[model samples]
Target: MEVGQVLHMNAGTGETSYSNNSHLQKKVISMTLPIIEEAMTNLYSSTSPSSLVIADLGCSSGHNSLFVVSELIKIVEKLRQKSGHQSPEIQVLLNDLPGNDFNTMFKSLPSFQKNLSSQLEAKDAGPYFFSGVPGSFYGRLFMKKSLHFLHSSYCLHWLSQVPEQIENNKTNIYIASTSPPNVLKAYYSQFQRDFSTFLKCRAEEMITGGRMVLTFIGRKSEDPTNKEAPNSMWELLAMALNDMVSKGVIREEQMDSFNIPVYTPSLSEVKSELLEEGSFSIDRLEFSEISSSTYYNEYNHSDVSEIAANSIRAVAEPLLVNHFGDGIIEEVICRYKEILLGHISQEIIPGITNLIISVTKK
Candidate 1:
């Protein structure tokens, strides 16, 4: 499947919406805050361009998107005031797929503007502007030498499109223990192509000293089929789908053919890709684990499984809907919740190890 057109977080502020259920992603953004701050600090101090151009690739819907812009604004404005220099024109560009819920995101800008006015002083404030660019970051999204800093959190693990010729890996949505050798190669190859293109595109668009901070789910081991691999949530999802098939809720072929365009690479794989591209110097590489229990804290329930499943639903529902139709969404989520309950109870689900990397254009 073409991810750019179909892959998006569940929209709106409903119970199952990404906007309401994005605490996990917010956690990721917060964990990478120090890296983002440091990069912004360095970019602002060294270049001090007349216009500070910034782009947040894969800026999905909801508060998490605006929260990033707010932080960048505060950081730059503070640096300007401290140096006693006239503020640079800060133009923030938010990029995501065309299918993203930009309307819901744009609707919240009024409050974002109001909050920004309260947070920063109006004195000598350079005019800051924001424009949404709907496109895939796997290719170029801006003019050459235009961007000063780039930030993307909880993205990049998704391939530009689903891997081809994985027909043998039936019933497994991603790289699972049961997947064949060909399936593994297909996923990694697609990631290499997609990530290499991403780096090349960004290198062309960003200035010489520009820095980018990227945070995404990655595995610790070189093995892609580890029991607790970064994308195990999808494995549990596959179990649910198979159960549905047995119950005649969905056809066996429907479940067997469905595969998400997500690939959680090992740290070594990421390093290899970056080395091959050679567009950016690696400044920092670190991984931190965030608990699945911590990802859900809305109603204060002890059932961590359902909470975790709900979080997964917010992110995966759209993709499922695009593939299987929306009629089975409720059933799939519920079955997935039950499957997760058993899975979480039987074993301690390891929290996802989020990889945070800061790189500078060479």
Candidate 2:
């Protein structure tokens, strides 16, 4: 399914802003830049490269896109300047689902470019270029051995499609409690398969020794025993969907077919996949759990509660609309808001319940 086309409208929480995400990105980049520099150096072994191609996979709309891409370029430019080599032209590719809000991304590009241009003018850096490659990163987006550096944050783990078993099981059981034993198996199996494909695709697209840094959410549990295990946040999300279903806001069938496309990988799992894809060696790997508090911060009193609920809706409403039908969406979203607010105000602080895993490719 397309990114926001199927399950949740904003399944990836793609609406997250750069300001809210600065801390996470900063942390990931600190661990990633060195790895990228080393890989790029290896890739350009004998030649003095003129332009650096940095692709940000799973790049969503809003300021985060501009923020991350600009940051990546700045780092690369700084490195080249220090090395006394004329900076290579920068080619930045922003990727996301086919249906992503390109208007926001496109509109922001000029400003991003203007900022980069100003910086280059300051350092006597050469002209830099930027573009958007709209497609799923689970598949190839570039020609063989083309990209010099690739950066993906909180994006690599999304499977290209929901597991077929889960999709087919819609009529067999309720969406809430319905996933067959094979749902997660199918999901993980596809993840391994798609991830292997992604690695292979990147291996093909990235020049040998090219630099690729990836940061994504991971599960604390080694692996889920089944599709419904507590370790899978998708399960909690599914529960939220079921609640909507119970309230007649969604169809049982819709719930069955809808699934969040994200899959959190364990550190070991990622290492194994990277190795299987071949040619890439992990230069660095760091995993840290972050607070989920970011989820609740968007709302203030009514607005805060409104968005805290809407944030989940941003992800879920799309799915409900796709499967259950759009008519129930507003109702579902409203109910979702009320329920989430009640829980947060009454039960728990909105916090991140995820681990960040950053990997450097050879």
Q: Rate the local accuracy (lDDT) of all candidates.
A: 0.86, 0.60
* Candidate 2 stretches greater than 4 Å from native: 1-48, 119-123, 167-180, 225-237, 293-305, 345-362
Best by TM-score: 1
User: Could you tell me every candidate's TM-score relative to the true structure?
Assistant: 0.96, 0.79
Question: Per-residue alpha-carbon lDDT of model 1 for 207-270, expressed as tens digits?
Answer: 9989999999988878888865456788888888888888998888888789989888878888
lDDT by residue for model 2 over 1-362, one digit each (tens)?
55534421242324433323334444555545555555555555545577777788877665466666676666656667667777677777777777666666677767777777876645666566667787766678888878877778766655676666566655332222454667657767877988898888888888655677677766555644323212333444455567877877566776666665656666778778777876677666656544445433544656665654544555445555655666766665565566556655664542332333333445
**TM-score, candidate number 1:** 0.96
Alpha-carbon lDDT of model 1 = 0.86
Q: Lowest summed lDDT over 10 consecutive residues: which window, candidate 2?
A: 225-234
